[model samples]
Target: MTSPSELPSTPAPTTEFEIFRGLHYRDQPLVLPNAWDFASAALLATEGFPAIGTTSLGVAAAAGLADGAGVTETETLAMARRLAGLPVPVTVDIEGGFHEIPSAVADFVKQLAACGIVGVNLEDGRAGSALAAPDHQAELITAIKNRTPEVFVNARVDTYWLSLDHSSTHDRVRRYAAAGADGIFVPGLTDRTGIEQIVAATDLPVNVLYSATGPTVATLAELGVRRVSTGSLLYRAALSAAVDVARAVLQDAPVSSGIVTYPDIQRLLPAR
Candidate 1:
């Protein structure tokens, strides 16, 4: 795999608006693998993920902070800077902007843009509110575009996740699109009918959260989804695997001998 430094340093989309549009027409759905930190981001980039996203849950957990609480802004930005040096594009999950003011959120995005991030996921699950008022969230989205138009604004609407009325999802998506969002993310939506309705109703690309029970990738493609995100699934899976491994060791259960050799692991380390 090519080193991030070896990749061309194309200037990010000149405007956030352009970045949002560019992500939609790609030949296939953007299969984004969310990473927790530098090593994960680097390995995923090396594995040829054209774009990588930061998982807020993963980041916050690593820092011993609560996810979506606005406590990891500095940590998130630091990770973005490191990822910026990688070959593929990096889009971060900025949980609710860590602040209510749109300008504060926009300021945070400007720092990310300066670090070479091409996109970000700004969700609308307001702290404590069932959902941030559509108009209020739209204001934040518009402010971000106005401040840093080159960063792809993935405006996430968590209506379904918050157990709010599903009917409001479409209206919120439309409002986000009008607010200069490049893509719309509906994470808790899984059913075929609901997915189709959202896709049919929105002009922007619809990003769906991949669920084991939801339609398969092929089905999502057929239904017009332009992006599929794993969200915290990978992070959770890693935790589960670790716990299982620990239990096996404690119980003296036979373990697979096909693990990577120390030499192989050493090969991945940067030069001393």
Candidate 2:
């Protein structure tokens, strides 16, 4: 594995945005690992990921707030600021842009871009299995693009995620693309037919949330998925592993040897 010291420092904002955008066009889908904090982001970058994204669930849970409730705006921004010095470009998941007004959402995104975030995942899913209207969501995308065109806007259609309107996926994908979205993310879409259909729906790069039970990375690449995000999986797995290790210690059983060493983790961050 390449050490963090061997990797290049953060690139200029415009170049970084271009690099993040170009990752989606590679032969293999960009296997994005969502990081909840600086250590996770820095570690993933040291391992040579092209880019890193923040998981709303991980960030919100870590901050003791609820995900997708528009309650994590400040926490998300703080996370972005902390990640500004990483070796790879970073994207933030700003749930519903943290506001109802399009202009307000744009203003918030402007702040995120200013923190060296190259992209953002703006979902349309609301609380209680509801979804924002397609037109209104498109307006939000437009406002964000108009405010910060260099920042890659990954418009997230939560039809499958929220289970609200399955048939509207194609329409929403096209709408967001027309509204100047740099990519389309449809989480909870697993089947091949559905994946192919969404890929064919728009020319914009398609992103899907990685699922253990879903098709493999090669399969998704064949289906034309440009990006696959492991959203919250790492954070959740870390939590589970910590609990299992604690139980083993209590029982005087051998703990897992695959754990990262304290010194290794300490080396992940440089002196500030």
TM-score of 1: 0.88
* Candidate 1 collision pairs: 4-87, 15-149, 15-150, 16-149, 16-150
Clashes of each: 5, 0
Q: CA lDDT of each candidate?
A: 0.86, 0.93
lDDT of 2 by residue, 1-272 (tens): 99989999965536888989989988999999999999989989999998999999999999899999999988999999999779888999998999989999999989988988889999999977799999999999999999999899999999998888898889999999999999999999999999999999889999999999999999999999999999989999989999999999999999999788899999987887
Runs in model 2 lying further than 4 Å from the true structure = 1-14
* lDDT (Cα, tens digit) per residue for candidate 1, span 196-269: 99999988889999999999888999999999999998888878877888889999998656654577555545
The lDDT of model 1 is 0.86
lDDT of 2 at 61: 98
